[model samples]
Target: MEGLSEKLASKLHKYSVLPFEDMYGTVSPLDAFVFTNYIFFLIIAFVATLVFFVVAANKTALVPKGIGNLAETGVEFIRNLCVDSMGKEGVKFVPFIGTLFFFLLFANILGLIPGTLPATGTIGVTAAWAVMVFLLYNYIGIKKHGFIGYFKSFVPSGVREMGPLGKWGMGSFIFILEVLGHFLRPLTLAMRLFANTFAGGMILGIFGIFVVLGVKEISAIGLLSSGLSLVMLVIMYAFKLFVGVIQAYIFTLLTTAYIGGALHADEH
Candidate 1:
């Protein structure tokens, strides 16, 4: 352990760990968990959403206010999606879908904060969220279509009408494919967010390491480059913010698609 520490110390002239390593070490001060950084951001995201809505609701404006405008933007965005995807029936599920989108968007955006790890970077967090989305839509589908109807909807009856196999064969094939695809959606959704956030986090970590190493190793000349490295780190983080937003949007869009599928037995 001593030798390892020495080695890391020597390499500190050329490399550095991302910030807040000590805070998220082998055991966190908060709960002895291995991933304290993720917990921290999860709390922040939860609180941020709570605070935003609480304040937004506190003020009631006849025309429009700043917070009202912000709330309206989010509401309108989700409203448009819900209407387009699920039609009139979509209005009822707006709260569910809207909250899901905001929670994810807030969590993803939290990764851009200094000295903080993005919770979405962790596969566990992403997978849990993905699974929640999967279950909710499937529940919605089952509830609206009924068990027999929903199962039947999975098969492509239209194709059976045209072919020799008739309804039986085509329905079987489509049912199998659709079931597999449905099961796969959660995995894909989790992976997309996890991969993007992990990559962005890694990039930021690398730039931070460069800055620390340059400052330690190369005398005055290296010190100057350290400043440039810091700038690069900031730029990378800014770009990552955009990635977070896009991924969040994609996740919400896919979720809406899933819900819409559940709503329309014909589309299933």
Candidate 2:
């Protein structure tokens, strides 16, 4: 068990990232830029997403069918999510949010395939996405209400209304805390996606190892344990599929909420 644990620990990092040279056994100029397994899968996801949408667009009809229907259904889901989170203003963001949702959904699904890594399972990929979201909502807020006005919204209305001493004391402290929390949003978003997907992959890998080890043992007990592990792996794979969809929805939902909050900061 200890040896198995050690082996699992050593192999688990493969789910995160692997350099081009390690993967292909040849050095390339791209290696200097840190091209990796996750990045390769990320590009595949991006291209797949682009092709899906393009095909869907070309195949659209009054009564959508097949890929068109699936595309329409996905778009409607994202549109509703945005509207519910941000109201009418959210409609304008449907394109961005929808793309993000589908990309993540595809990435997660692709990772389920043998020999492919989940792009979002990597911290760099998730962090890049979260940073983009952070920059976007903040930019929207700044554009809607000038830079000064947008930042001033960080302080609670009640705090700003207090007496001079109260305003400078409690208000400043709250403002600082709020700012810190705001900055932490990207970190939370990145970590949440990376941890969930990466952990899911690791669990699957560990179970796979167990199945292999069980099969290698020559006893009847070995066969029974391998069968049990196989069943559990199937169950876990199904759960991971559900989790992938939920994570994509969650990330998109939070993004819309953040944008909505920025759009209506004065309301709070």
Candidate 3:
């Protein structure tokens, strides 16, 4: 079991962010600053996403087909999510939200390839996305309502209705809690996506190790175990695909909800 664990760990390390010299045995002055597995795959995912949408756009017509239909369906899905979560005002955010959704979806799917790592599996990547979202919604809020008004919205209406002393005391307390929760949003978003993607990859790698170990044993028990491990690997691969799609949707959904809340904070 320990040996199996060690093997799995070594396999998983290949997917981690490492310097170009360490990962690819190449030496360059810029390697330490800009070259890493994470950045390499991220650029691949980004370029792939850009090319897909561009191609889809060119293929657009009154009656869509093939990739055009797939692209339109994806657009409609994001459009509906935004509109449902943010109402008519959400229309303006469709492009940004759609880009986020497709980029994440492509990244997650790309990782399923035997040698690639999902960028979202890294905390740094997910954190960058979460921070971008945090800044965007907060900026929208402050733009819609002045800076003071935007901050003031953190206090509940009931707090304002209390007696003078109670209003100040309770309002201050609730305001602090709200501010803390607001700041924690990015942390939670980053951790959720990172944990799910990283853990899923780990599980897949473990089962893969089991299959390899079983194949090497060569006895009756070995064959049985190898067969079982292969089955589990197939099951896990399918499950990972579903999880990839779900995590992408969940991230996008939460982003839309956060933006919507900021856009309509006065409604609360």
RMSD of each: 5.2, 2.6, 2.6
Model 1 has a clash total of: 0
Q: How accurate is candidate 2 locally (lDDT)?
A: 0.87
Give the Å error, residue 37, model 3.
0.3
Instruction: List clashing residue pairs in candidate 3.
Output: none
Rank candidates by TM-score, best first.
3, 2, 1
The clash numbers for all candidates, in the given order, read 0, 0, 0
Q: List the candidates' TM-scores in order.
A: 0.81, 0.92, 0.93
**lDDT of candidates 1 onward, in order:** 0.77, 0.87, 0.87
Summarize candidate 3's per-residue lDDT along 64-140 as a digit string, tens digits: 99999999999998999999989998888999999999999999999898878887888878999999999999999
lDDT of 1 by residue, 1-268 (tens): 1243454443332122222346223442345345455666777898988788778766647776899778877888999999899899988878888888887888888767766667788777789889999999989888988988888888765774666766666677778898999999999999999899878877777677678777777588778778998999989978998999899889889989889988897662
Clashing pairs in 2: none
Summing lDDT over every window of 10 consecutive residues in candidate 1, give the lowest-scoring window. Answer: 11-20
Give the per-residue Cα lDDT of candidate 3 at 162: 88
For model 3, the local distance difference test gives 0.87
